[model samples]
Structure formats: structure tokens, C-alpha cells
Target: MIEIHAKTSAANTGSASDRLHTLGLALPDLRGNPYYVHHRTVDSSIYISGQLPYQDGRLLGQGIVGRDVELETARELARHAALNALAAAVQAVGELDRVRIVQMLVFVASTPDFGEQSNVANAASDLLIEVLGENGRHARTAIGVAGLPLNSPVEIQMVCTAV
Candidate 1:
């Protein structure tokens, strides 16, 4: 059982959606959110909005990455934010396997001295590939910010190709 970094990756078969389930994970319910729509489709492209690390309606890692929050915690938050972005992709495309990730942008709210933004973003990158395989691989940018909405520590956005 080669862990996917954070308590997953025991099996390596099936579609990305199936692999998601095999890893004991489920996409969040983005049914009727009043904040903002998760994604929009233009032609064959899905433009996903920035997603924060919210699990079961509770925000996680609400602090600076290098100050109050540790590196591993921030990385896990990035992974969860990416998962949320994946959910947005599915919502727009109707199926996870039907689309391919094109690009990703990760935001980390951290201290000015922190320099591991890419390392934190790697958690998202690693999980995407672990679940979606080649289709999940994508061009990415990781940036450190002084602050984010709701004081969350990490956020992620994705662009996917659909239909």
C-alpha cells in the first residue's frame, strides 16, 4: 500500500472516479451554495472557481502556513482544496473521466519568510495524478499570499477540458 502521501493509494486500478472511491473519498455536495457557482463551461473548457479547504462545511487550516499552521497541515489543506476543484470539474462535465485537467493554480496564505509554496501545492498535484492518472497531470502555479478569503490558509483552482 504505497500511500498517496496522505492516507490513500492502496490500489491503482479503475477510472479516476472509481479510484477516488477506492481511496475512501467522495466529492463534496455542491448543490445549492449561495456564495458562488463552482464552475462554468465555455466550449470544451471548464473554468473552475477558487476552492478553499472546506470539509463537511467546516474550513480547515485557517492560519498562515509557516507561522501557526505546520507544513504538513497546509499541504493537506491544499489536497482538500484540489479535491474540491475536482468536484467542480465533475459538476461541470457530468463525469470525472470525461474530462482532462488542463491547468491548476494554488494559493497559500503564509508568512513572508515561508518558501515552500510549491511543496504545499505538490499535495494537490500528487492527489490529482493518483486519482485521475495521466488525465490529472496539469500545468500548475503555486503562489504565496499574505491573506485569503475567510482567512483560510489554502485555496486551489483548476481548468479542465470537457466534452
Candidate 2:
């Protein structure tokens, strides 16, 4: 179960973190250690490494977003990637409430005919907004790609301000 932080009211009417928990989503464990770090911070800004739709170290969806993977599935994977990004941000800053999402770059693996990158990205955007309220709003770019690492359907990376 995901833990709802106390500072989520300004992001939504209810708690965004609580919404996430009710959706049955859980943040992935950050694989950072002394040797390798998943996120880095400079001043109050935290840069989260690219996150895939992974849980328990396994990539969730495989194949191209508009081909082998359906749009809905890709969207769901995007949500997972968003969760992973949030996990990284929270891990780096020590609290979810301290995170103010600044930007998100979403990449979707797609076929030549696919053109719904924005719709797919909305899955992540909506989730972030629901979880963090105003702090979750951020500039975003959605790009369709030929492929992605680990054959995953989507990948996401983010920048956040830790207050």
C-alpha cells in the first residue's frame, strides 16, 4: 500500500496520495545505493532518472505502444512510470509533500502510424495532478519513439523542486 503524505490537499480536493493508494498503485523501491543513485539533487531541485513501468524489478508492459501494446495498457504503464518517478523524488527528498513537480519527459515506444502520444502522457500527468495537486502541475513533453529500453512500452523522467 502507498503511504499518503500529509501535504496533498492543495493538489486536489481530497488527498492525491490517497487517490493513488485507492487505485491500488504502490511506489517502486528505488535501486539506489552508495554505488549508484537513482536521483540527484542540486540546490533544492531534484532530477529523477528515467523510470520504466516496473514493479519488483520487472518491466510491466512490453512491445510498441500502438502495436503489440494497446493504448490503454500503455497509458496504465505510464501511470506506473509516474509512480516510479514519484518514488524516486520522495526517496531523494525524504518526503512526498516536499516534491513540486517541475517537468516530466515521457517517451512512448510506438509504430510509425501511432500518433496519440499526448493521450498516453495524460495518464502520468493526471496521476501526478491527482496526487500532488497544484504542485504536481508541470511542463511536459511527449515523444513517440521507435523503441525503448527493456522493450517497455513507456519511460518517464522528471524534475522536481524540493521545498
Candidate 3:
């Protein structure tokens, strides 16, 4: 795992793995055509839109939160969400090292009584910290929604700092 210092700098002197270990996370695969671009902004922020679970032109899994999907499934879906976010980051910055995650908002589709949103959100957080080190740590919010696009169990969106 890479360790990253919180010092705001563009050069990635820290190991990506160190950052992952710091957050107890792993790098997720960049799959699907999921990504985002920064709007015209003078600040160093990149707005990554919501990412859903998808691959090979198909949604990975979809259903009610406590129905066909379990908590672990939600976690995995969260990883995919981060993977897509990374793709967006790389597309914007040309490299992961030039990017730092600033914030994440996760949406989970669940029943009114099913409440394990934070557990699933951590999967994305861990992956981000692993891939971007200290830059990955950011403010986050996880909420349960009645539904997501294509009935997906989870959707994750992010904001990032880019050089």
C-alpha cells in the first residue's frame, strides 16, 4: 500500500499502496466506460459524476438492498464505483499521481428498514485511499435511496483535487 502525506502538493512522492494501507484498502480495476471531466473551473477541483455498477455493457447486479443483494455485494459495488472514478481521474489528469480525492457521496438503493449504508461506502473510500494515498482521504456521505438507475444497488460520485 502507498502512504501519502496530507501536504497539498502535485508530486506524488508517496507510494499509492501506502495510502491504501493507511485506509485499509485495495486498488480496484478500472472497467466499463465510466468517467467524468472537470467543468470550466479555476480551482483545482474535478467533479466526478455518479458511477454505477457496470461492465461489458451490462449492469453487474441489481435489486433491492436487502433482497437479491447483500451487504458484501454492496461493498463490491462500491469498489466498482471507485474504479470508475479512477478512470475519470486518469482521463482528466493523464495520471493518477496528479490527482487527489476530495470528497465522495454514495447512494444505496434499499428498503426503508435496511440500513448498512456506511459499510458499503467504505469500500469506495478504502479503494480511493489505496490508489491515491493521502490524497484519497476526503469528506464523504452515504445515503440510502429508494432506487438507482437500472435498479442498481449502489451509485457513487466524487470530487477530486487535480493538478
Tell me, by lDDT, which candidate is best.
1
Per-prediction CA RMSD (Å): 3.2, 5.1, 5.7
Q: For candidate 1, what is the lDDT? A: 0.86
TM-score of 1: 0.90
Q: Candidate 3's error at 67, in angstroms?
A: 1.9
The C-alpha stretches of model 3 lying farther than 4 A from their native spots are 1-42
Mind giving the per-residue lDDT tens digits that candidate 1 earns over 1-163? 2555333333236777788887689999755579778998888888999999988888976888899899999999998999889988988888988768899999999999999999999889888888887777789999999999999999998899974
Candidate 3, residues 30-138, lDDT tens digits: the string is: 5444343422224677787687876645688898888779999889988877777766776667776777787899999988888889988987776675566567789
Per-residue alpha-carbon lDDT of model 2 for 1-163, expressed as tens digits? Answer: 1322333443466555666676677677866547657788998889988899988977887999777999999999999999999999988878777789999999999998899999999889888977787789899999999999889889999999986
Candidate number with greatest TM-score? 1
- Alpha carbon deviation, residue 96, candidate 2 (Å): 0.8
Q: Count clashing pairs, candidate 3.
A: 10
Task: Write down the lDDT that model 3 would get.
Answer: 0.73
Count clashing residue pairs per candidate: 0, 2, 10
